[model samples]
Target: MDVEFLLKMGRTKGLEGVEIYKVETDSLALTISNDKVKEASASKTFSMGVRGYVGKKVAGVSINDENLNAEVAFEKLSSLIKTSIEDPNWVGFPPPRKGFMNIACRDERIVHADYAEVMKAIKELMEIMKDEAVRNGAERASVVEGMVRLGAQKITVANSEGVHTEDECTVSGIFMVLKTVAGRGESDKSFWIVNRRFDFAELEYLGMNTARLSLMFAGAEKIETGEYDLILTPETFAGILASALIPAFSALNILEGRSPLKDKLESMVLDEKVNILDNPGMPFEIGSRGFDDEGMPTSAKVLVRKGVLKEILHNYYTSARMKLETLGNGFRRNPSSPTTPYPTNFHVQPGESRLEDLQQELKKGLIVYETIGQWMSNPYNGNVKATATHALLVENGEVKGPVKGVLITGNVYEWLGSRLRGIGREVFTSEGVATPGLWVEKVRVAGE
Candidate 1:
């Protein structure tokens, strides 16, 4: 979609401003079962989204039909805006800004990668999983689904105030799941091999790591239910901590009285070592972007520092409504959606201790590698009730056996606050949040 037509028709349509987002994607996916390829497919699609304002109200429209007329879509969007309810929050669109950082977000290698190369990587991953599964005494091994997706998108923003901006990006990733069965015992695990740069080496390890987890957990045992020292692996910590903090830091939630931090600004919410950040400019990171949906330049901000709540995330609208400045976190899932405060690369700072050291310090505990329902509980109150699916029993600084059907229940704030034990130096990035292995003491664990 072009901005010239949007600008010319804005005056006649009673529209004050307009912005457009265009996206195109190509992907190849294959499934494996019984150590063989069961299905394979490829797909490509293009979509367009447009948003604008009429009077003081805003509305949006999106079209997935690549062949649709842009003029018709814009007209439809303008008509919608004319009939839409006035949103007191929709004051206006953000003005164009300068100083947007140019980073290496688009990789030609991934954008131009063909089906043959992706298949080679998938087969290589399967081979690695097969070797690891058998080495761990697995009778059956399967890569349920292996997918490599190449995506490219170009977004353009233009308004009546002469603010125009454009940016394009290419993304690449592989996702897979490995399952193993041995002696009537079965285990399953999944992982993502995603990054701007396509590294075959990283893809190789994704398979082996998932295979090892399934093999180790295939014959899980139970433990006595009791309060115990707990270690959350990086991935688990990332999921829990991100889910808990994301909503709490949203200024929109604070405005709606749903955040625990609504009145806790500048207060101590975590341990002295706890520092959370929202960094949108980190090079090659999954959430890295040049500018947010509102054409605002993205920058890094420390949401929390030394246990004190520092800055609440804000978009242009929320900042304006709250008398604060935008932190370049504005985003919309689609053009038809309203822009809101969203973290680009939210993560907790790593500490000095390693995972092995955290385990060694705990004479008796559980080392949780992953969980099932950590995000099912409420993030606002920090109450955590999660089921650990692949936890390892620890005794005297060593792993005893894999424990299954274990539940860890506690208050997350207390665990990360006064009850904090240790934080591992190793950080894992999952679904945008990067966190280290976290150790908490006296956690309530229910086991059999």
Candidate 2:
């Protein structure tokens, strides 16, 4: 698509400014059921988002038809602008800037491989899982269902203000649900691994772990309801942070009075040892990008340092309205969605304690491996309510048994504050967030 042509057409239509964002994607997916490839599919899609400004009034439209021309897009945008109210804080689109960092965001294997090659890889992964399950003593274990997906995407952003940027990336992921049958009881556990590049060894490791955990969780029992120390795996903690803690740092949420951190800037909000960074330049990370959706160059920044709130995320609109500079966090969930302030790669600096060390140090605790319904947690008030679907009880530095169906309830602020005990040294990255296992001193768990 010719974004320059779109901008020119918008200008000819008497629009003050124009911006166009385009995305092209090609994807292939394979579904596995009962240890066999059940379905395979491929798709290609294109979408364009156009925004036009006339004085203070602005309007936007999304074009999903690849054949749609710039003239038609502007026609739709113009109609919306005619009936739109003027934004009092409207400013022109951002101008082009330099200093874009180079990052490895694509994998050649995924970008160039065909369906047959990908299917072979999935078959190999399935074999690895079966072997690992046998080695771990679950001789009857099998993969019940799963999926492997590979995607390549190209993004382009252009504006009338001489801002133009383009980026391409490849993404691959594997998700599997392993089930083990022992006597008359059955246990099931699922694992997900995603990255900008494909790594066979990484997927193998996840598959083996899932198989082992599935066997261990067989005949799991619920624990008594009480307060206890909690050890959350990296995946578990990342889910909670993404759902309950990250949104509070959005400048738009703060401005709209939907964030509890609205007045907590520069204050200590977490443990003194906790450090959080919004880094979009990390190599091969899923969220790593040279420029944001608004065509602004992205950079690494400290969001929290030594427990103090340092910076809040902002996009062009929110920054301009608040008289601040854009931090390159402006992002859109989809091609048709409006740009908003969002984190790129939310990274929590790892500490020195390993997972085993933390587990041994805990006199009594529960190690949570998986959770559900974390997205239902409240972001505005920092209230967290999640059910622990996969957890193990530890007593006196020893794994007592598996615990399931436990409800974990706590406030994020309180948990990250004095309740935070330790951070694990091994950091895991998935779905744009990088974190390690987090240990909290005391939490309320509702079990039998």
Q: What is the alpha-carbon lDDT for the whole of candidate 1?
A: 0.77
Worst 10 residues of 2 by lDDT: 65-74
What's the TM-score of every candidate structure? 0.92, 0.96
Write the residue-wise lDDT of candidate 2 on 1-448 in tens digits. 6778778888999999988889988999999999999999999989988888898888888888654766777788899999999888788788787889887898888899899898888888888877777787775878899998899999999889999999899887878998887653688889886778888787888887887778778778999999989999998999999999999999999999999899888999889989999999777778898989988888888999999999999988888888987568889877655688888899999999998999998888899999999999999999999999999999888999888999999988888888998999988898889998889988999999
Tens digits of per-residue lDDT, candidate 1, 51-126, equal 7886678888886765467668767887788788988767777777788888667767666777677667668778
For residue 411, give model 2's deviation from the true position in Å: 1.5
| Local distance difference test values of all predictions, in order | 0.77, 0.88
- What's the lDDT of the predicted structure labeled candidate 2? 0.88
Task: Look at candidate 2 and tell me the lDDT of residue 405.
Answer: 94
